[model samples]
Target chain A: MADRSSKRRTLRLKTPISAEDIADFRLGDVVYLDGLIYTGREGVYKRVVDEGAELPVDPAQVGNVNFHCSPAAAVREDGSYNVGAVTATASFRFAKWLDRWFEISGCKVIIGKGGMTSEAYRKHLVPQGAVYLTTVGYGTGALLGRGIKRVVAAHWLEDLGIAQAMWVFEVENFGPFLVESDLQGNSLFERANAEVAKNLDALYEGLKPPVMSRYGETDDRKDELI
Target chain B: MISTQTLQNVAEELMAKAAIEIPDDYLAGVKGMAETEEGDLSAFVLRAMLENYEAAKEDRRAMCADTGVPRWFVKLGNEARIEGGPVALEAALRRATASATHEIPLRPNRVHPLWRTDHNNNVGLNAPEIDYSFEPEANWIDLTAVHKGGLFGTDYRMLFPGDGIDGIKRFLLDTLIAFGKRGLACQPAIVGIGLGGSKDTCMVLGKQAACLRTVGNRNPDPRIAALEMELKDLGNSIGMGAMGFVGSSMVIDCHIEAGFTHTGGMPMSVHAFCLSSRRATARVHADGGIDYRTDPKWFTPYMRRETVEWQTDPASGARSA
Candidate 1:
């Protein structure tokens, strides 16, 4: 095993994080959370944002951290929840819902798989004092699961089912997330991408383009697919 | 005869194993990558992944919450007999998939394409796909379960023979760079390239190549094996690593599986087996014996046979046309 100690700045935060709490957070800093976080994605977003349904639980009570996730969870025989692992899904797909999600949920922190674009952060998150925290390895489900002290509640079981339902969790030391986007809308991934893109021309210098090109294929390597 | 009861039991166990355990081959490959990765964030991610694997084993929980879309590949021995034929075998596999989904608590990822109906189990229309292959001169059924993430890190393209290897390299780079941003591919992955066959077959072969073959395993063909090494290096040289950080750890390994295709076309597909890279295998013999392993050994000599007829040299057990 390689050295587990990370040289990057690390911070522990409590959920329902205040503006001052994340004000100093910088891109590439590590973060872990304590308190409560709720799972929500397309299903919860569609219900509350598009369908105009009210949130099942008050955001003030549940804490303002929203996780772009669905747990590997099940309903027990007695109708209790059994959550074995929890990991974040890609957050970019949920960008459309974030503006309304922030207003409705009062979410100050968004935790997910891949962070949203810097453009998205500028538009939707920064105004609401939210930052994007991306989960480590993108598959650190077991480690994250160990952080969960208990399942606080699982709403919409009948409507959205297990994977898509809103499951609130009480957690401690519950992450190994990187601060992908900070208050200034600076993105760690975009910064890294800019650096990597500089070498793309040389990497593909000798390789010839395909005989048949797909329609609308961008020649610019810096452009992101999402 | 192999009993349906035995098949189901083994299938369920294989599902749990695939979800929870990071196979030793993959673990070693990632460990090697971690040691050499220089990017600060990328190295941190790799270290975290190593810890995550241990945490998964210790807790007996799925390594990834995505748990991915669970599927099976069964290689049957020609002489093997089953209790109720292929129908029973399929049913047993399906039953095991559903039961394990609830018990192991896999995210029910499969949904109706149109209506979005969820059975709350990982089974639905054509879900938990069971792909099959056959082996010669044996009497056991090999069951391999692979749980691969359904989104991102896979692509297909049609290329002409005139384009050649350079075109293939360009496509690989394109796919890697596109999805590699923000690490959407969940990379530091095992990249598998399918170089021939019709469009669909090309896709299948690429997926199997990525999910079935262990890290450092190569194609039997010398030229193709060399290309695998070259591609692995080319991918790593992209100045990308885990979470698309600026580092040289984009690919832990590269594999290529080819099939006969239209003469004028060299249809290709690419697949990335992500960080979790979940898979497990088991063999159930006719005499009620069961053996478990991480390696599927899916690409046997028989599987890669090139001629119309397969023949084996009796003296050395070498394959001959």
Candidate 2:
């Protein structure tokens, strides 16, 4: 009732994020996440869904946001997990099972690099009341340097390598993340794609004939043949 | 003669530099893109990237957590005598990688592709990928190491003969668009397009172009150079912006290298590196004097062998002839 459409909000959210909190977040809204967070990726998803292994930590109780990241985090000789140190990989590869990750992990929000698929948003995300957010790609060093405050816990050390283990993080001002997918079934990626495609014709028109014709026929000629 | 000690030291320092510092040219490219980029979203992301670079350098930490697999391109002088043979040079590089793992505290990224096994030291079978080219007249060794992350799409590619320049452009554009839409490739991306060679030749050229060439360096061949500039503009026009948000600074530059192809077919390869664009260079002379370089003279093979007499401006991050 608080002018849900136009009343924009910037939230600094903590863990055990409630349904009431996620409801305020719409597609394209940027949010800063703090408190408890955890990471997973293709391998972790496979392990959870395919192998039926229990996640070492439960986001439903402790953390409400999950990150689809496979960080290159190695422990030092002291054997302590390097807290707040991580590298974020691309998120699109894990698009297929993101909804399932949300279901199993009970995380209300997810963070990754690329935007999630429209199908995932439409079918699984909307019904389940979740969102997929995107952080800046290759901004790993910066994210850890400034955003992530500490590493709380890690699990599945022996079964999954350090890269694939479940890591719970305590973050401070964790993001200016773009909400690519939301409970409303809207996706920023799908919308941005359509917007970009509208300009493709204009872009193609600017391309001159290949500098020196080598193999293929000219575009003008090809049009006639077709 | 360049001793094994010199080789190992240079390699170790280069690896540390590759992880800790973003090269000057790459930094300039990012700043340039940020300056000209439109849209508040693009501006915000680019500013964050610039800040990130500064933080990494100041903190003496890797700019990115995913310090990718260690890769080295070595130009060995034929005349230069080594304490051991080529195998010694290779061993020095391997030792440097392992040492840098603890020294620079590089994330041990080497892992078994199938078994999901992590080699904590970032060394193993064919781990630190080294490509060697022997120069007959040279008396020194020049090595450049680049860290290729998992997110930067593909490091190597092959296209059929039917894919001419038009098809090649189409492939490059399509691939960038597809991956970039997913926020992969990490724009403003640096693309290396290698054309007209066997698969391996083109792949190597592509990798070199992406990891070696600086953003503003022109290809020696005028025609190829013109294409490189054209591709840079075209790629930026796609509106992928900093992190695939709508804006103007999608690509920092596109570097292309061409070699003579088989008459029957045309092969093309593309190597894309994310904005982190981490690389470092060092030279080991026969007299045991060593020098490290901020500007990697990878394109100018002849000049790399000769004594480099260049001045660098820190403010603009530019190199003068």
Which candidate ranks first by lDDT, i.e. highest?
A: 1
Alpha carbon lDDT of each predicted model: 0.90, 0.72
Which residue pairs in candidate 1 have backbone atoms (N, alpha carbon, C) closer than 3 angstroms, thus clashing?
none
How well does candidate 1 match the true structure in TM-score terms? 0.96
DockQ values per model = 0.68, 0.29
Task: Kindly list the per-residue Cα lDDT of model 1 for residues B224-287, writing each as its tens digit.
Answer: 9999999999999999999998888899999999999999999999999999999999999999
Residue-level lDDT tens digits of model 1 in A132-183: 9899997799999899999999899788888788989999999898888988
Q: Which 10-residue span in candidate 1 chain A carries the lowest summed lDDT?
A: A1-10
Assess the local accuracy of residue B196 in candidate 1 as a C-alpha lDDT between 0 and 100.
94
**Candidate 2: stretches off by over 4 Å:** A1-10, A58-61, A95-100, A206-226, B155-165, B301-321
